[model samples]
Target chain A: MTKYNLPVGPQHPALKEPASFWFKVEGEVIVDVDIRLGYNHRGIEKACESRNYIQCLYLLERICGICSHAHTTAFAQGVEEILGLEIPARAKYIRVIIAELERIHSHLLWLGVAGHEIGFDTLFMYAWRDRETVLDILELISGNRVNYAMNTIGGVRRDIDQAKREQILGMLDPLAERVKFYTDLVTSEPTCLARLENVAPVPADKAVALGTVGPTARASGIKVDVRRDDPYAAYAEIPFEVITSERGDLLGRAIVRLGEIGESVKIIKYALQNLPEGPLTVKAPRKVAAGEAVSRVEAPRGEDIHYVRADGSDHPERVKVRAPTLANLFAVGESMKGAYVADIPIVIASIDPCFSCTDRMIELVQSRTGTSSVMTWEELREYGIRWYGHGHRS
Target chain B: MCGQEQQRSDLARRDILAELCARFPGEVGEAAAPRPGRAWATVSREVLRPVTEFLLGCGPGAYLSTITAVDTGEEFQAIYHFWVAGTELNLRVRLDRREPAVPSIMDLHPGANFYEREIHDLMGIEVTGRGKLERLAVPDDWPEGHYPLRKDWPGLPGGESA
Candidate 1:
């Protein structure tokens, strides 16, 4: 039998974002996996250099549609540190509210993707259908499903009015019950257990050595969570436990994420009850003083760090963002080495790979000829033309 | 009581800084309190590897949170930020702008791989000894030699609008 390579994407049905996965397969197992990113790289970091602190909030939010609030919150905190401004307690609670809401939505979306990858269409549909509840809650407060644009330099842009607050609370009890039900179904259900349990096991040592963060590391027994280790936002005040499991397999990751949703619900409820009263935002200086700050937040996927350096100008001297998925992606690649190809999607899905948030680059070379092929911008147009039929030259 | 604990923590931070300076001698950069809870140290790029290795070895639990690179136009600065339970130690390494490459710490800290790639991709600073120096965030077709974060580089057209 001859060996062949298949490039899964730069565009593919399996992925929701633009990323290419080259799988070197011998029969049914992946021999080697090469990832190519930079497909969706819009030069965002570069774009941040020219934008002022206020404008960069919106820019950072656009970094990842699913994790927009986390990115913006981290970015806002970084700027706040530079100016040495402490957000009002009420604003901190609001930030926590939105951050947890974003986590709920992101985790639910991942559950749907994991279900879809395992050939469980029914579970996938149910997961996404229920995920809308979180999205609706977010929209009620922020007025947008994807980019909330709620975060500002000093605090947040919008406050949760009484009506919206009650609406959010109204949905919580039932949503919590549904989440628990799904949690049990995923963990105890025979079919899911068969597919996920004991598959793609990453040892605790390997996970730590690889610098895996978030649930991926937690699943492997590393007991490290940025929220707990280095508390930020309102996490220090709110009480919730960091979930961990020693199994370090597909099921372990799933269990940890599902368990986290329950914790997020608890945190949101606590934050709402303790919500403080004050203006939603403070007046921030248009020009920030020269300084540097490093802010770290625990995104649903893992630790999201942003380093901001300001030079007393509208624009930041430097803005460097480190998304959690970047660390987890390599660990996922390492875990996939010995797994059966049938389990590849489930394993990859387990890490909840978000190339949009995780910066990576990929290059495509033909396996048969071992030659690199360039897809010129003009060729991309032609390819689109051939696929979409050149739209009938009128 | 919490206030007293905070004061004790601050004193401990100073002691830690003093110990680092005495141990490493001239290698340790000036000790300055950046903020209430943070401390900073600048080291030559030559000693970055040793300093980071020493810090990580101090505790079984030390972790490198992230690595950030700033382009000073004439020189490039790479900052390795590490944190234990409550304290943060920032190591700044300055590299010549013309060469703009640092010996890779991926060998010491595999977690540094992605951070190094991000620095490589955005700041155009090469991290030698890394397995892959590929771009992590920028698009594939973005013009080569065009780094957006550099001070002198012209950013995207219609800059503020973007």
Candidate 2:
């Protein structure tokens, strides 16, 4: 049997970020996969080191475009903890609202990507089109779409007025109805289930042992949610159930995220109903005192932890971030082991891999011969054209 | 600063730190006072393996949460924050200024691969036994020896004003 290596992207159409997966395949089954990241490495951690407490918030938000609010919120919370400052009640409620909105947007994006991976164009279109509603709601509140600079050190930078609150509530009804319709379709639809069900089954024990977080762990029947376990923001006040599935497969993860969308709807409604009136942000000290603090938030992906140590300077002494994608990436490789080549993309997509957050550049070396081949983007494209069909057909 | 659950976590962490100190003797330095629901102890890089072993082996998989490095111009400090299933025993290991190197924990916990790589890239700390330490977060064309986090290192080209 001849062993062949297949390289997929630092620049592939399937991926949203720059990452390469070199797979050794025995006829169509992948024997082993070697992943290379860092192509999109913008030195985010380095950038954080240079920026002050306030500036770091904006920089961190850009870490992953989809989970921008999650990053900013976690970073701000860490700084706030170091300062020992309690955010205003109104700010807390607004933060929760934005966080839940970000979750809905992220899950919807993932669903659309998953649909696209499985050749379901209609599902992809529907998911993304509906996702625009959440984006619009976010824009109305924060004044921006992607990097909503709503978070500050002490509290939020923006406020939700009555008009904006009314607009958000009006949008929720149609949004929730559409989400429910899609959820039902995805669950009962034979084609969707056939591709996702039991494809990359990660057992409950394995998922926990491997430190999988977010919906990936929830799908594996783990009841651990950072929001529930270690309540932060207005999560303690808001009543919501943590969704989980015992199946521990691609479909299980999908179900957990989809169900959570309804829960987000419920949380947002509760927040709006009980929205308090007060100052949006408190006055933070210009110079941070010498202290260290850790903040963890349940991001759209999973647990996002930010560790900050300040040395009485505007700039942080040390800032450490552990994004959820870092944990789930390991599980992605584990899940791809027994899956078919055709199912590889879907299985990988199921983990909702965010290589942008965690990256290292590719260093290609021949498997059998041990010769290194540094292929450029154009050369890699040509190679794809030669092996697979024309770029469009593949 | 005092509560039933907080006190319990503090005591639990203290016991763990005391045991580690006794086990490592000179390697474990003076214990830092406990913070809210957390405790910390400083240790030399030599005792990192044993301390980690005791924590992860004796306890219920005191899962390694993160391995972070702080560059203080003159020296680089690598802090390994570990948390058990229930308790919080946050540990720290300080390395020398020059040639900051520590043994890789990939054999103990497979999840440490990326964390270690990140430390290597940003702090230029060598994880001694790790087969390959590729740049995890920095760009490929980034200048060598230009660790952005280091106190003395120059800022990025266009980053001064921003």
Query: Evaluated with lDDT, which candidate comes out highest?
Result: 1
lDDT of 2 by residue, A1-394 (tens): 6566666555432222345677676755667876666666656676666678888988888777788888888888888877878999999999999999999998898888777666576888999999999999999988888889999889998889998899899999998998899889889886677777787798876775566788998999876677765678988778888889999988998899999999999999999999999999898987799888777889998888888888888898788888887777777777777655556566667877642221222345556777766555434323423432322222
**How accurate is chain B of model 2, given as a TM-score from 0 to 1?**
0.79
Per-residue lDDT tens digits of candidate 1, residues B87-152? 567778888888888888888877777778777777788887757687766776667787766777
Interface RMSD, all models, one decimal each?
Answer: 4.9, 5.8
What value does DockQ give for candidate 2? 0.27
Instruction: Supply the global lDDT for candidate 2.
Output: 0.75
- DockQ scores of all models, one per candidate: 0.40, 0.27
lDDT (CA) for every model shown? Answer: 0.76, 0.75
Candidate 2 on B1-162: residue-level lDDT in tens? 133244234223335666667787877665763444355778877767777777776543346767878876567888786655443455677778777899987777776777888788777888987797877667767777766666676666667434
Which residues of candidate 1, in runs, are more than 4 Å off?
A1-3, A12-18, A354-394, B1-19, B33-37, B130-132, B138-144, B154-162
Lowest lDDT 10-residue stretch of candidate 2 chain A:
A354-363
* Quality class of the docking in candidate 1, CAPRI style: acceptable
In candidate 1, what are the lDDT values of residues A1-394, reduced to their tens digit? 4444645446421212355666676755567877666666666777787787778888888778778888899998988998888988889999899989888888888888777665566887898898899999988888888889988889888889877888899898888998999898999886677778888899998887787889999899777777766678887788787789999999899889999999999899988888888888878888989888888888888888888888889889888887787777777877877665456556766888741221222233556778755543224323323432432221
